[model samples]
Target: MLNVNFYEHIDDTLLKFAVIVSKSNGKWVFCKHRERTTYECPGGHRELEEDIITTAKRELYEETGATTYTLEEVCVYSVSDGINESFGMLFYADITEFGQLPESEIERIELFDQLPDKLTYQDIHPILINKINSFLKVKGILNNIELKDNIIPDISDLIDLYNDVGWSNYTKNIDMLKLAYDNSLRIVSLWDVNKLIGIIRVVGDGYSIIYIQDLIILTEYQKQGLGSMLMNYVLNAYKDVYQKVLLTENQTSTVKFYESCGFVSNDKYNCVAFVQFKM
Candidate 1:
């Protein structure tokens, strides 16, 4: 994504940014700081090994400690920080609930639904405001996103899904072993009225980090964007809520697929053994 022509006007450009936008207290909420103004979203630096949304979540909590909120991905834009820092991705999030701003946020924080009158122009950049506004207008997704409480069914058709779909290749194996052992594994199943369509198994300490052991989807259920959903459900159910979701797979397609679901490579980390041989 680098072009000499683009950097000609800026020097030593480094850093990408994302913003979290929310509506709480019956009003629109934007974070204000020495960082940026013009009613910007809440987000900060991209860390060494962190994914974008994770960075956003960490930043929001560190700055505000307001854990109760719904997050949505709006868009990403690149820009210069006006210093040596440049080329940032700004993401928008909507916070439906508001909590008291921590003391650390007082001097650096200002929240507003509408543009402040005669607001100090220093922290907020004009171009950044323009970018946020443009995105908000086009996407126009306010009030459409509602809180969802996932409803889980008792008898899922997920088993039949594998038998009918190609992903059944692995899921069928899983079904055969279902009654054999519990083995401290948490097998979350998703199904419809007729059959089992998707499945994933997670095993770990059940506290710090959980490893995704198996993920199977009926081939017929593929390409409908369910893989990401299943991964995300597992992640939130374990990783985000618990701080770590780790899985190892040899397939390039699997890696790419999970990456899109917010998995990143840890060079310091590698598979000890996808399979352990009987000694």
Candidate 2:
């Protein structure tokens, strides 16, 4: 089985290619190669000294004849099977116009709301499309995401969100958690229609510092940039504060995720953080 991993960032030294998952109106866009009957997203390998964004744009135009569109970065992704690891950037595009298809390896372009069965990389295409949709929802690319400040969500949803992420300790102390939420300096909750999907709460003076206490998305809703979205909302809301901080378990992936949001390791800045535990 191919191993696929998603990242917030990675160096060029490990990247192998880029993929652009595009949509026009509200339908998905895919390309067919001249020698292949199966469909695939518009993508290709990087050229010498070419930036990855340019690679995605070039491949999208060459494959689908996209003439007018806006693109957004989704995330970095990697795949491997114990032999060699391959890295790529994931991108999403909203195409508004198309020109005549170029005379290239592409045979044709197709748009769909429901994907066709015959895809070039059958094992990978579907997963990539899902990731793209998640990107859309999280980044508000094709969906309306409502943000509520100081709005309290349903207790059940909050419990589910915390429990889904293995933070049952918070769930077990739901009363205390609710009290804390009620007193937070600010609360940012993200919603899809009426569903409580993501949330971030900040505490501290509105001017001096803002400490993020809880930032969560339901387990089934992770990896689509929802976490980053929540972080961005709080960071921007308190951009002028001298101290913006959070403390979480020291795991590699978790640390990387936070770092992507303009945060640095305390050690990197020659500062130290101390935490005390009560037994």
Candidate 3:
């Protein structure tokens, strides 16, 4: 039996290989070895004196001819076959450009909307792919959901979303909700064709700090990872800003969700938050 485990970090010396799960044009990238019909993610054993990141880059380029791409470390993973264990660093890559495939064991490259059934490391690869997807905070390809930036959604749609989520306070005064959205520094909305399903509102000067004023997903879409996708979009947009802030009710689930997105309580930084709501 094979067992797999994931970690946020591990000692560098224990990492013997680098495995990169990559995508090109939003499709999953996999390579077929010259000797094997099964497909695998582009990766290989770490070379002597080479850091794991360099191994990942070299393997990706050699296996897929991916010349231009962005790579991010996902986590450290270990696979054990009951008795022996091996460790590797997992990475996620977004490939934009490719060159001629280098002379290597990889026979060809393929792209698929989902993982292929025949995988080189059947037991190991699926676990690694699932880990990468979870690390990315994406449940799956969000079919038919279009993300619109800075578009103030129609008041009726907004009202429906708020009401569905039990935030009746916002729907009670439609005019004020519209006005608030209009004044937001940035607004990202998720539209299922004509229906508004989720939104994230930001308010800040765009330089020193940005506050997540509101982030909501329609009740039906709450657990599908649409909320995390919206939050990630805004986080990447303001990544250069010094501070990203938000306030929320101190509920267990809500706190865990935000913490998973890399937020910490003010007390952690020896600070406090103050808030005053209209009576």
- Find the candidate with the highest lDDT and give its number: 3
lDDT, candidates in the order shown: 0.52, 0.85, 0.87
lDDT of 3: 0.87
Candidate numbers, best TM-score first, in rank order: 2, 3, 1
Which stretches in model 2 have alpha-carbon errors above 4 Å? 8-16, 22-39, 48-51, 68-72, 93-98, 107-122, 133-144, 206-208
Global local distance difference test of model 1? 0.52
Candidate 2 lDDT, tens digit per residue, 1-279? 887778876666666698998999999899989999989999999998889999999998999999999998888888788797789998989999999999999999999988888998877778888887766565653276677888888788899788888887788888988898888898888877877888998999979988888888876667777788789878888889998888988886688788778888788879999988542
**TM-scores of the models, in the given order?**
0.37, 0.77, 0.52
Candidate 1, residues 76-137, lDDT tens digits: the string is: 34443444324444445555544666655423445565655534333444444554465555
Runs of candidate 3 exceeding 4 Å displacement: 1-141
Report how far residue 85 has shifted in candidate 2, in Å. Answer: 3.9
lDDT tens string, model 3, 148-194? 99888888888888888898888888888988998899999998778
Find the 10 residues in a row with the least total lDDT in model 3. Answer: 134-143
